[model samples]
Target: MEVSRIRYWLGVLLVFLAAFCFALKGVLIKLAYQYQIDALSLLTLRLLFALPFYIGIAVYQRKREPVAPLTLREWLWLFFLGITGYYLASYFNFIGLVYISASLERILLFTYPTFVLMMNAVSRKRGISRLQWGALALTYLGILIAFAPHIQFGNQHNVLLGAFWVILSGLVYAVYLVGSDSMIARVGSQRFTCYALIAATIPVFIHYLIRNGFALLNYPAPVYGLTTIMAVFVTVVPTFMIAEGIKRIGSANASLVASIGPVFTIVLASGLLGEKITALQLLGTAFVLAGVSLIGWKGKKM
Candidate 1:
């Protein structure tokens, strides 16, 4: 029992660490954009660079257990998941960040749970309990507080557009989460991620050919270097860690721990990147944390 408890804490800590590492990707991409990397281009570099690692993990896992191979339909869905959720989602998010602050983007992105909840209610009538709803309310309140200072009053049209992209990212991301789990049950997690990422690369390459006329090789070393780091640290390492964490602790405990992502993002943005943090932002973060808590609380209740 003591060992299990220790392992659980260790897993939670690692997952939180993974969230922080993942949060840094936005700041890095923001830096890359300053050097003229377009949205698709950045995503291209990110996905392509990480492709091998994802596949490697899958192959390794496949060796350990004779896992079931993906069926044609599952492959098709995984392909779509990779393209829409991984490539398209990242593409829009990068572009949106160019128009909005990381602080605001994170706030909007964190609204995904609300979408997930709505989807659940629609798909099945098992709506959230009252306490869970209150927690969600607090969570969003915290998110709002965190972004209080970045809120501009006039000509907020671009903010509106950013919100749209962020919401789309959330929606598709929810689909990927829901759909991917279904796939996981079908063909195991490692193989599912590996094949899906490889499958998704097809659209990314096509996007590059159309957008940049196939001169993807002309960029400086830093572009490739940063892209590779984004793939490894941002994509491979953290993903593996998250999967491990979630495996050690089931989804219920894992969801609550994962909610630490936004809070990590805010602190990293403020302290490391020197983004401003206001009193309202702190309060809002508290609220958002509350919502995340509710979701996990609900998950555990069952």
Candidate 2:
């Protein structure tokens, strides 16, 4: 019993850390924009820095686990998941951030859990649980609450456009999550993540090469520094930590903890990027947190 309790708390800590690290991605991307880096270039740099780690992990896993070679079909599925989830989703979010405040982007992106739940229900051929439905409602309600004040004040067209991009990002990421479920089961999570990330880097490289050939070496030191931090601290570390958290506490609890990401991003954006935070936004954050908590609690009970 004591060991089980310890494992649970450890899982909670890992999830919290993962969420905190992931939250930094939005704020860091916003900061990178201050250097006049375009979304594509910034994204390329992030992937470039991240690629090495994924490659190393793949090599290590090859030696350590000695799994069977992935079939062409499995490889193709992983490639699809990687491109859709990490590459396209990231690309959309980064581009959207160019027009939207980090806070808005984070809030919009936080809707993925709802998408995930819906996808699970549809895939499993069952109606969503009432608690899950309620959680989704509360989560969206919170986002709308936070978003309402911004809609009233911001440039309407730009805000709407940015919202669309971020929403699309969330949708694509949901697809990735759904697709990844089976892949992660077939190959272990760590192995699947490493392989998928390596595959995702291909498009990023191609995009960057076509856009700005050999210009990667020309960035200022700060761009390199920021991208490195974004890649390592936010991308690599949090990806594996969240994976481990799922292994321990299960995906439901891990996702609930991750819901805190919006709040973290909002606070950081307010301080670092000078984004405004109103009472409505705080209330919205609370609603999102509560809704996610409900989902996690309900999942645990089940």
The clash count for each model shown is 13, 0
TM-score of 1: 0.91
Error of 2 at 271 (Å): 2.1
Put down candidate 2 lDDT per residue, 201-271, tens digits, no spaces.
89988988998888988877889999999999999999899888888888777877777888888888898
The digit string of per-residue lDDT tens for model 1 on 211-302 reads: 89877788777888888888888888887788788888877777787777766777777765677766776677667767876877776775
Error of 2 at 34 (Å): 1.1
| lDDT score at residue 154, model 1, on the 0-100 scale | 34
Which sections of candidate 1 miss by over 4 Å? 146-148, 153-157
Local error of candidate 2 at 172, Å? 0.5
Worst 10 residues of 1 by lDDT: 148-157
